[model samples]
Target: MRVLSIIVLLLTTGLTSCWPTSVSFNDTGSLHACLKHFQMDPLENSAPNAPINYPIELTEAIKSGIQNNTRLLLSGENTKPQVTITGKITNYVVSPIALQEGDNAAQNRLTVSATMDIYFDCPNDNYTHEMKVVSTRFADYNSSQDISSIESQLLSEINTQIVQDVINQILSNW
Candidate 1:
């Protein structure tokens, strides 16, 4: 019995040793190590059909998402940042989807697109890079519902998707 107990103890110790000592929960992947400061410029709304408030809402959402997912800090107005993101709403359109009997629409799809230009400055590595990413996402609502009644919810979903896309673009550089 003593031998068995010793074997079990050794096995437990061996297993524990193989386990990772530290786990990182950061979603920024390798970016947390290099880029520490970020700045977001006010987005321009070039989409003629988009609501006036869309640029503000999307800017805030992207900022919040980055802060929550990465270790990067927002640069102060007076400070130079290691990263800068600027973008414009390029497209916003609503169209019929899933046509039914007599060509009536069963659902309507709201699509939003944005063009982002991200600049990275890593003084430590003497590296500077710029990338342009265009992210487009959509949400659907029942044709019976008026778009005005559901626009906010649809925009919220699209914004989340756009945020993820932007993050992915940033992380993929490394």
Candidate 2:
């Protein structure tokens, strides 16, 4: 019994020693620590077929996402912000994606595309940097369902994806 106990203790110690002491699930650190304030401009809708309310919804989602994910505060035009974001919805389309027998539509996809420009104001350094990002995301639904009934849900999913993409781009600093 003493021999078995010694073996078990040795094995457990060896296994634990090989494991890391700490782990980080999120590698994307905070956006530049110097940036304390951010300004977001109203996004423009250039897509002819998109709903009138879509631009507003997406803008609000992006704004809230940034505020919730980062430590930066939202600033108005009266105050100069360290960062400014401007974008436009370039495309919105719904089309049949999967076809079944008899040329019937099995599924339809809703695609939304947008373009964004981020301006980093470095007043202390007397220089400014701009980054442009174009992101496209989609969601699919059964063809049997009416698009009007599920449009809001689909947009919500796509909004989350786009928001994540924007956040990743900002943090990547590339």
Candidate 3:
């Protein structure tokens, strides 16, 4: 019995002592950390999903980005970059976390989760991988007027996160 117990402990210790393992194939954080560690850029300014497969929330986010920012190049019939970012919302929700009928604590939680699948069309063709990441945040308002404020800030932040995840995948795998 003592020998068996000792062997079990030894084996368990060995396994636990091993360095942290890689993140899931769908985890974007792992992908980003891996890329940032190497100080490499992972994007080619291409939209991976030409026929974008984002959820309604993501679509709204994209629209908002295009409207407010002049940096995103509009995709046309013959404008494709070397790499593209493809992502979809796996989860999106907004709920009131605390309500006091006033600005005291009436807060809403906004959360969005998405996974990115990056593919290289040129330079290194036939490279593809997927990453999943989630983001959540909170906002407070006393009336519906706050909707615009929250959407402008929280929604955009979440959208940025989703895009960054895709970018991370491209960078890390390269």
State the lDDT of candidate 3 residue by residue for 37-153, as single tens digits. Answer: 111122222323212333555655543443343223434456554334455545555656666755444566665555545333443344334343333333444445465455656
RMSD in order of candidates: 2.5, 4.0, 12.3
Error of 3 at 19 (Å): 33
Angstrom error of the Cα, residue 55, model 3: value is 5.9
The most accurate candidate by lDDT is 1
Which lDDT tens digits does candidate 1 get at residues 80-105?
79999999999999999999999999
TM-scores of the candidates in the order shown? 0.86, 0.82, 0.40
Local error of candidate 3 at 118, Å?
Answer: 1.7
Total backbone collisions, model 1? 0
Model 3: residues >4 Å from true position, as ranges?
Answer: 1-84, 98-105, 121-145
Query: Cα lDDT of all candidates, in order?
Result: 0.91, 0.89, 0.46
Cα miss at 65, model 2 (Å)?
Answer: 0.4
lDDT of candidate 3 at residue 24, scale 0 to 100 = 64
